[model samples]
Target chain A: MKVLEQFEFLDDVRRMDARQVIYQFLNFCMIVASALMIWKGLMVITESESPIVVVLSGSMEPAFYRGDLLLLTNHHDEPIRAGEIVVFKIKGRDIPIVHRVIKLHEKEDGTTKFLTKGDNNRVDDRGLYAPGQLWLKREDVVGRARGFLPYVGIVTILMNDYPQLKYAVLGCLGIYVLIHRETN
Target chain B: MAVLTFMCFLSTYYNDDLADVNIKVGSVQVKNVADFTTTRERKDLAIINNLGVKVDLSQVFNWNVKEIFLYLTAEYSSDVNALNQVVLWDKIVMREDAQRIDIPSVDPEYYFFDDSKGLIGNENVTLTLSWNVIPNAGRLPRVQGLGSTTVKLPSTYAHSSGRI
Candidate 1:
């Protein structure tokens, strides 16, 4: 009976490492905070709300696949040109579209309107724009694509497509960190 | 580790096989049309004449290259924004066999009108042939070809073609 009690007490102590638990929790929080800070810093440097974007569709087939990743930069003073790929978000839409600029209309007031089309697509993006919106304004542009990597962003796509998988992975990570005690 | 090696291999592979690009601005026709398709208030706009663009992009093809998106642009200076650029024509080359493009007399692929009505009286506009190299993997880059021509638009407005 005494041996069993001692075993139970040892298990309890091992399960509830108070100092270790607090340290692990704080480490997790620090990681999350640093990630956020880095993302926000990138936004400021790139002058784009989302400096990095994952190619979500094959509309820009042959140029960008569904899983590729694109790096973007938005220079407010820079003049936009034709044939350049730009990522723009339409009004009332959460998803952004990446396409090449097919046309540019520079107004006398220095504001320019852009017309975009996918290289694989036959028709222009007139139908993709908002109702009564003939052209995309400068304000509507998210950023211009500067660089890209192939298929690294598939992880993001997988996470979004399978919420169960995402939850499972996240839960496993959390549990592992919480239970893991530093063997110093 | 495999991905890193592949990326390094791709970056080292520099295939500069683009032979040549030739573009000829056939004519510049100015017209005024009242169309509901465009939101422009001005009825006067520049109608680009069919371009005689001959390109041998066969050399630009490689194992990593997917497609070449070529566009003909009319770049000119204006008081509005210091530079007024518009895409007059564009073509997508999926394969090298489709490289020899001979469009005898065709309108601009998209609208060729300028926002500040700068297309009219825009003489000495430069026409350039540039292409965006789409790759199966690695970085996508825009390359400007050596083919370029100058077009001078007549000051008078030509008769309308009744089409955009």
Candidate 2:
């Protein structure tokens, strides 16, 4: 059976020399490092710490849905405007909320205050802010919504929602990578 | 799959040949409202704006555009603040339905209130229309209107039955 063959392959991998084990480990490390490098490169190009984001909720509705991937950009020169969607994080919250900038208040300083609201909701996002926080400061904004792609980020969302599934996939991938030998 | 997705994302765009837009600001009046945002005793200055706009965005609805977020903004220079842009009104144009929007005369959809209560006799105010084209799989590009108008608020408060 395929399972028996996989077991035999695992046995063969265990019998391999120490150099083979080190080589496989180095290959795995290279894969992880390159993925991190790619992410960092994207961050640098987009001018945002979090260059890519997945839509976790349906607040944006007909335009964006759950599992949709969004590209973000934050420019220092351009101030945020009304009707443009923005992704921001409150002081005490870890999750970022995506909403439209309904109002702008520029202060005596150059910093502009932002009032945001969800398009599908009936009211503004005053309730979503921190207990004492009224307007979002410039630093609170992560980025403005620039590009969108639908339904590709579902794998990540699924993994997040189900820990067992995440572990299972990771375990399977690790085992497969370790057992399979590449022919050069 | 990745190649197809990238192609789909890159295919749609807002026309470089922009659409025509017209904005006219009628009058502005200042009123006092309770400051719900802050505990400051000073009443917030709520300016009532009457505006008229005609937008022909039929060309913006390409094959990939899902909707267009159209809004009218009031930009002015403040003594304390360097620049102030307030959104007075807005509407969503769905691709399946209408594209051109016309308003003979209408009040602002949202309240135009200043936190500092700065506008009382300010003469220099500019009104311009703008839109965000929402595509199915691409970047959201903002487009500015071609025409803008100047508005001057009256010195004193104006009382109307609807507000203020």
lDDT of each: 0.76, 0.77
Top candidate on lDDT is 2
Which lDDT value does model 1 have at A66? 91
Residue by residue across A1-184, what tens digits does model 1's lDDT show?
Answer: 4675666534433665677668878978887789899999999999999999999998888778998888899989987778899999999899999998977767666778778888778788989999888988889889999877788899889999999989999898876666566566
Candidate 1's C-alpha runs over 4 A off are A1-16, A107-109, A181-184, B1-6, B9-20, B40-42, B45-50, B58-64, B78-81, B95-108, B161-164
Q: What TM-score do all the candidates reach, one by one?
A: 0.82, 0.88
Q: Chain A TM-scores, all candidates? A: 0.88, 0.89
**How many pairs of residues collide in each model?**
1, 0
For residue A91, give model 2's deviation from the true position in Å.
1.7
| Clash list (residue pairs), candidate 1 | B17-B59
For model 1, state the Cα shift of residue A39 in Å. Answer: 1.7
